[model samples]
Target chain A: MTIVAKFEIPYLRFLDSEGKINKPLPHFAKNSRDLISLYRTMVLTRTFDAKAINLQRTGKLGTYPSSLGQEAISTAIGAAMQPNDVFCPAYREYAAQLQRGVTMAEILAYWSGDERGNQFAANPEDLPIYVPLATQCLHAAGIASAFKLRNQPRVVIVVCGDGATSRGDFYEAINLAGVWQLPIVFVVNNNQWAISVPRTAQTNAATLAQKAIAGGFAGEQVDGNDVIAVKYALDNAIAKARAGSGPSLIEAITYRLCDHTTADDAKRYWDPQTVEQAWQEEPIKRLRQYLIKNKHWDETQEAHLQVECNQQIEQAVTEYMNLPPAKLTDMFDYLYASLPAIYLEQRREVEI
Target chain B: MSEITLVEAVNQALAYEMQADDNVVLLGEDIAKNGGVFRSTVGLLERFGPQRVLDTPLAESMIAGVSIGMAMQGLKPVAEFQFMGFMYAGMEHIISHASRIRNRTRGRLTCPLVFRTPYGAGIHAPEHHSESTEALFAHIPGLRVVIPSSPVRAYGLLLAAIRDPDPVIFLEPTRIYRLVKQTVPDNGQALPLDKCFVLREGSDITLVTWGNMVYETLKAAGQLAEQNIQAEVIDVATIKPLDMQTILASVEKTGRCVIIHEAARTCGVGAEIAAQLAERCLLCLMAPVKRVTGYDTIVPYAKMEKHYLPTAEKIIKAVEDVLSYEG
Candidate 1:
């Protein structure tokens, strides 16, 4: 047997850095509703994130992690996923969750420190936010393994940050997926920073995609700020995985314009000029510019989009705040099928 | 009735369960081709192929975390941790996820997973090879701990553990894996998880123990019998959801109790048993409960392991002290 050339980083670009589409973009839908939906979701996500940070400042929500500049990656990847497919996300994928099916109220409730936010919806399609970093990668592999064993034609998508690639679970899960030929697509949102540590301090590898080669898997690096590029990369990866070809890794190279979370201040560790330069490549702005240049959007439509996004966000916040306070017993309810004796005792104490 | 060692009995139970249910899968290091380090998973790979009997990397956390996901997806996974001492690496998954998945999912998911490991001292193996950490699991909610002392009990309890709807930690004593032999029934009926079995019944004293120490307690009881001291031996198989009624009844009848375990004395299962007996059966006790357990020190290498574990002599001494008490 002979080894083949390393997998080329797959990509499909519609817009260049100067905010110009290479050619006339195809219209998949007859009425341009699809494009309008995508734009609306992006604006809604940005509005929700800003509201979350404001809530955190007002002591309404707990520490919030704002996905300010990474909306394109989440929106595009989430759009490519089928409703039946399982999505395992890290803490910063609130936009992805909302687009997949989670309501804005539910997202706000989670950041407000309520257990109900993590509860499975009536028709559960995704798992709760896994907080232990790359551990979710292993779960995604297992889910995909189950699908393969049962001969199910569903793909499992796992979303992680660049910092998670350094964890042991990431390597173990990817290696297992490769060996078993399980149907899994790993998306790494390389935002260039892990808390206070920058990407340079995380690993010497020039690109996170190259790390996948060590595990005998195919990989690609896409411009995460480009919505169309992210959607095309994920769509092809998902298609390959569903075809029984094994796992693939996509590293979305983006930047976090905001602090890590409300609790962190990035200015202390990162150069202020770097932050200023990254803001120019914001994902939402880049996509909006592409739409305007293609004659698909104008200032009148932009004004209408802002008004629509604000109204939707205000309604969601009103509904979320009006809901009853969270029950303390919810903490112990989902821990087991039968309540263990210790938790029973704790519940009794809480009642007292 | 064919007699077989504890390891053979465990292997037979796995073979029977896999044949009975297609959802049962075994995954661990060397369990597929090499038949495991102690050969507890021998012949499983040949019978179940690579999909059912997966050979995984040496990462314990991955093995356990993936099992949790598999179990959530409606598969019964039996994971092996080469040795009980190495379970520390996977403790977070076991404690945080496996034990809480059923409740965390609000019954939307159940982790019917079994973690099988060889535990206890007397193997004379290197450091970190023999450890008895059942107490730590017993303290956690939503998990069941099963410790079978004989071949027949191990087979029946293991079957029960696999079929149970919750996560079960099956601790097999490596010291007695090859030493004990009995006729295990071929039929797949499992013994209950939280019930105790009386190995030898006597009204003079109640000796409660499980795992390898059960044999030692029985030997001590036999030696006491020679001295006109009749002692009852009860094997408390499941540590969590303990059989308190059976124990309280035995203590009430015998008027004295002695607990034995191979784990360290501090915060061990023996303490919990003693405390429960004190709270429930205090008035009936003729003397304070006595405990024979290992010291609170790291399990040393083979050279000094004999001094680190509890022996028959220690159980007999504890029995004598309890019998000689005037209060």
Candidate 2:
């Protein structure tokens, strides 16, 4: 038989794990302010994650997913998109939400079991964090279809975990995006473990990014711990999408440096040696090291930034705790455009 | 006004809505070029062109999910499933995302789309083609389950489902898609949702039903009227926010009730109406509520379908049983 088709998967990396330059840097790297800003956002995410886990442990918050080692993936996607573009996030995309104008107090309030926490005043087009794995991919495709139908220049960005690639929703979503040639970018945070199921057991597709090739799109992999590499790949993909280049998938290789959530104990399944090795390549420390070596940051600035983050987190906690409780009618109020007669009568007994 | 079949009425209503509102679009497998498997969307693609009338892949989950995304973005998408049984593949998107988008976002976003599918056992179709699973969609809190029994009702209700600002499960009865014809005015008018239609009025016994079972109940009511037992017939157009007021008011007058449906007897919509009557209208109920429904088994293949569906004779028997009760 004659040859049918051939495809290749690409990989991208800039700064290595040891703060050494692995390749020539992009134009954005020359701007020290941009790098410093990205670094600051990663630090803010780490601080916010620690406080959220502490609150969960103290019984002040609901179950929370930490962005511990996967900060670069979320932060880069958040910083790459424009304001009119849509952002569809997975459950652990709090870092991206923060960068997209969602308040720290709003995040804290949502984790405290209040629905009002998701009411983002600045970004109404941004979807709330989806808990059901890769379902947001389909929503992203739909949003992209709307933009394409209306002939708009905006793009949509969606993120999911490594395990989400195993679900049928993921394949179905990408299939439609490819067929329609929609303007959306899908990023996979391959942090090695999907809540105790290792990446080895997820699939044998060689690499998750290669899955895009079968759906008729460009697929590439990047070093997720290196923030510079993530930003470069996402910037290129977002630009291509805006120029009507259809969809692209980026598989960011990283590790889960901490437990899956406060409700989980990684020691039960993960090997101690693996965890120790992963800690050395975490995202925040790599970015911090890159900033310090480049003379863009120093010890005094780091100390001052830590103090400010602590004060801001404390203020958010106070505001979240002092807010009035949600009304009981909130359950019935938002269920439909207008309350039907049946619900109106049922709402009487619950009224206080 | 012109005489048209139920399926033709569906096509006209869709065309009218697409012509009136630029945001309304159609998508499903074989819906655009093939005009749908049942010809319910026949002439939509030729009229609206390919941009508004989309023909998606054979992925039911993406079809439902993409419609939700479009609705959230201020577009009114009307998606169709080839058959009701195939809706199982899209149930996760329906129950989790489409039904919960409004409540999940705290009213910041709403899913104003219609998921249309042909259901019930008839026309000698295959195993998966014949199903009456309206109860499943009705069980979802944020969904509105609407079914049309005649041509005019189909036109009016389809228009209303597209205009409503929430997700609606529009289940059309395949058994009666072209069984009869009626004059439906293409005036772009929409009937109020979440209300029941009183098809026939009497005072002896009330026969409450929806979808295909409405035909059987009306036939039984006519038979009862000949035997000096004038029965009241109520067609429950919307199943979810069941206009229990109309059913309750009819029960209050007739003092007896019997519900007929083609779905399974266990946990069917008929059970909900029966339970509600026991709770609110117990004082006026002269006899225990009776249910005439299909068996608690999977809808059988073509040969056994006749035994699986609720017939007019069975509904008449149920009405007679309720009338014979002296307690």
Candidate 3:
């Protein structure tokens, strides 16, 4: 009998939870500039996430998903892509959306139930966040097919949850990308839980990254709490896709420190000891420790950054509250390029 | 100008559009070298090259989603599902994303793609291959549902669907793909959408139908004419954004109407047309408006298909019932 094939999922980690450098630094991390910017953005995201949950608690905002421990994965993908490339993200990718020029106010308007919020003026090419699980994976493959067809260097990076990898849309999407050799990357934020369903129950696979192997592409894992490791994985994958080498999948291991959303309470289904353990390895805290230990940040700078983030978030909240109410006709206007004659009376009858 | 079958006319229309617009591309299972299961996309790959003509994997959701993405990026993709029964796997994308993207994004991004599939029962194929569940798409707000019953209409309407600026669900009636031939010019002309084509004019009754049922309805109209009933035949080309004005005017003159369709009787497109007549032409309708449609059960297998499809005989019976009504 002849042996068929062999595959292995490569893992990477630059900084451990104790602020110790475990792996050699990538080019961007060798200096402090990129690391500082990443830290700043992660802090911004963490601050924003807290404010959003607060608003939901006070009945000022709708149900919101908190990216408590997974900021590094979103921030790393956003920072790694070029302006011309596209990003197709699932819900809870505020860090990436913010870096791609989606304003905090715009994000607020959307969560507050306004369609006008999705029309991004600065990032027109990027897709609006898809709430349906795993659907964006196929859209990213489609967008990448366009880039491949036009002989362009643009790549598409799509983010999904660990549970999404169980859906057929995820497999079908990666299959097309692999077969067509499309310029795209599938990033799975394996945050250990989907709402109430644990990762263990989601799939029996040893690692979520190995799912890409079935599609004939490389797959790997990273310490998602380590911002540098997340950034390094995206950089390598994005470069390969841009050069038309094909697609890759990276399963970033992290944990959802908060409940699934404001509508949920993790205390009901989660273990108290497990939740406390996850907080120690949260992305923002681990990265902040790494920055301080590496001498790139200090107590004085940390104090100033916290003050600035709060001020910025307060300004955005004010702008979001002051923005004009969404017009009643907005629902009818964007429905089609030109409204058909039959809908004229129906459009006229629309009321608030 | 050359006479061709409905399927041949479809092929010609696709070739014309891909030739006229470089942005137009085709994708589906077995669409490239295999031409297509029905040959409607034959010769397109050879002419347009693989860049514009692609054979996608056998995943309906990906085909629908990928085309939406491509359309958002300014490519006009005409994606075909092998069969309408197989199309349900992609219904989530069609309903949740393709139909909602433009409206949700406030026109910043739009999906201007076409989802084409062979629909309706008649050929002695499997049960899934024979369905007229077009009402499912018609119920979607942002999608335009277009069906062509004849060769000439197929050529013109398909071209218009490819050119329409919104997402379109273009269902071709497999029952009539090769049932008839007519001289259809290859001219790059498109018919108007969201309007009904009034095929014949009369005052005794109005016979309204679409898809392969158009043949059965026309036959009923001809038989009604022999009886001096003088039925008006309306070919409702586009089911969504229905042309109720034409049907209203006809019902006003005829004082009676019979709506024909092959989908299930409950909540079918026929029900929509019947309800519209009751709303807009209630006073003009001197008699009653009746619906001649398929049964409420699942579209049956091939051997039992004829009993399920609305026939010219059933349509004639319906017209007679409406004509005899005193209300």
Worst 10 residues of 3 chain B by lDDT: B280-289
The sequence of per-residue lDDT tens digits that candidate 2 reaches over residues A222-281 is 999888899999999999999998999999999988888878998999999988898888
CA lDDT of every candidate: 0.85, 0.91, 0.91
DockQ of 3: 0.86
Off by over 4 Å in 1: A1-14, A22-33, A122-125, A325-328, A340-347
Which pairs in model 3 have colliding backbones?
Answer: none
Residue by residue across B172-191, what tens digits does model 2's lDDT show? 99988999999999999998
Residue A55 accuracy (lDDT) in model 3:
84
Q: What is the TM-score of chain B in candidate 3?
A: 0.99
TM-score of each prediction: 0.93, 0.99, 0.99
The collision pairs in model 2 are none
Instruction: Tell me the tens digit of each residue's lDDT in model 3 across A199-261.
Output: 999998999999989999999999998889999999999999999899999999999998899
Q: Single out the weakest 10-residue window by summed lDDT for candidate 1 chain B.
A: B100-109
Q: Give fnat, all candidates.
A: 0.45, 0.75, 0.82
Ranking of candidates on DockQ, top first: 3, 2, 1
Instruction: Chain A TM-score per model, please list them.
Output: 0.93, 0.98, 0.98
Q: Can you write out model 1's per-residue Cα lDDT over A54-115, one digit (the tens) per residue?
A: 88899888898999888888888778888878888887787778877777787788778765
Query: What are the candidates' interface root-mean-square deviations?
Result: 2.3, 0.7, 0.8
TM-score of 1: 0.93
